[model samples]
Target chain A: MDNFEQFFTENRLKLDVEPLPEGFNNQMIANFRAVRRKKQTIRLFAAAGFLLLLVPGIMLLQPFFKPEPVALQESPSSAELSILTRLQPYQTEIESSTQFISQQRVPTEYSVQFQDFLIQLQIIDRQQDIYQKQIDSYGYTEDMIQQIMYNYELKLMVLQKLQTEILKINKLSKTTNHEYTNIQLEI
Target chain B: MLGNRQDAEDVLQDAMIQAYTNLKSLKSVESFGPWMKRIVINQCLHFIRGRLNFADLQLVNTPGESDETDYYQFSMEELNSTIQQLPDGCRIVFNLYLLENYSHKEVAEMLGISESTSKSQYQRARQLLQHQLKKKMNHG
Candidate 1:
């Protein structure tokens, strides 16, 4: 070792490091506990504050989402009123045809198809109502009102054609059964 | 070498608190002693740097009275007292290099100074400590 290194080594050998202050370890552990407790308290407060904000936030948003009951007898827009008036003449005829078709004895295989067509009519009626409401509330263009009228006329034509086909099938089945009874009498 | 025992104890305590708080970040548990020692050294340096400005370190003159021959005859207590009297920068370098057994390169890195500066500061501290010890020995 060099002179300075040797000298430092000798000095280090002779040097005495004082023992840590009495009860230092216990004091440190106590300090650590206090610090930990403080941190946990801070975290608890933060969680409490978050929950306080969250509960009121959810409550405040509930009313905006609660479904309101829509009132009946609200006057339709003038365009929709005119369209309904134009369709008034066909209303009785369409209703009678629908009742007759419902009363007819359809084949079990055709029952599901007939029910599906009725459902389609109901869906179209609902869609037309929604479009009418949109036009009234949003000041939709005349072209939009015309489109709704055209769609309603098309649905009426489809129902009329379905009623005619069902009536023809019923008449054919009645004739076929009557002819079969006559042949049995002859045999 | 941190001026007094009270200051040294305070730094040690603060370093311990810091070490405990950040213990989870330590990668090697076996190096805990050296890691804590580094923290203590850093705290001591921070205290010294706060007490004495960088300009003051440059202004401190190297003691001219003593040579290496004077250090061998002194008692450990005398040597310690003499070390404490060194200027802040020199004493820090001396303590880190001699007592802490850090290399000059490590001392330079720790102090954020050039290696040559660490070397010169250490030499100055040794010379001043020897000079102070010589005076005490002659008087006693």
Candidate 2:
């Protein structure tokens, strides 16, 4: 753009170069190392963060990792004997009700409801088994016996409610009232 | 704008530290030279603006001759000696537009000056450098 720029261009290499301060290069090397160390520290922290997060993640997935079920005693021991005897009738009733509900060719809507109740009943059965193991391990209290009896009764109640609802729905819906009326669920 | 060798050295060191810290953000190794030059320019601008208000510089009429990107490029040592001879506003505009190949608009934004102010200050810088160089050529 100007003769002055031509002079600058011609003398570019000849132009005095600014000398870096004494020890400046070495100081920069030291800083680079420090920065590298800091980056590594940040990476380590991130890894530690991920591992800590996995602790809760694994805990949340704990139900899927249930331990192998322990086999029940061949014969009931004296400690659990009294409670098991009291629970037998309700247990038989629950088994028969479950089979009857499953065999029923109910419409899909009531079938979905029955399946939900059945899953709940299975969860109660598992709970009762847990209390029985506790009785075996630490001996039974009246509380343990009462809880097992309560679980069985709850299952029967669920089955009865389902049966009553289906019967009521069959009566109200004109499609085929006599078809559902012919079937009776054993409590 | 940062007068004196001690201050210049300090800026250089600080600029090196800044570039080193953000090296990971640099996209290419080959561009390190220009990228570093840009950083140093920014640091110098920051150093100058900290003490001097850029808005205070007076603008003039008529724009200066615009130089090409590679035309006025020079070494930092040459710039250090050359630009310091200029006043605050002209020194920064000259350094950015001439030595570093920045456009007048870029210089304006960097210095918080109007584009017209950048151009005029550059014109003044061009006039001053021409006078100074001619004096040196004839006298020295």
Which has the greatest DockQ?
1
lDDT, candidate 2, residue A87? 74
lDDT digits (tens) for residues B62-139 of candidate 1: 544424464567667767767777888888888889888889999878877788778878777777776676677778
Q: Put down candidate 2 lDDT per residue, B96-119, tens digits, no spaces.
A: 776666898998888887888888
Docking class of 2: incorrect
Q: List the residue pairs that clash in candidate 2.
A: none
Tens-place lDDT per residue, model 1, A1-187, is: 6666677876674654554577655575566567778898999999999999999998999767543322223644665566557656566666676676566565443444456567767877788788768655554445665666676676777677767766665566576644322111000
lDDT of each: 0.68, 0.68
Q: What residue runs in model 1 are displaced by over 4 Å at the alpha carbon?
A: A10-17, A21-41, A56-64, A67-187, B5-24, B28-30, B50-75
Off by over 4 Å in 2: A9-16, A19-34, A41-187, B53-56, B61-83, B137-140
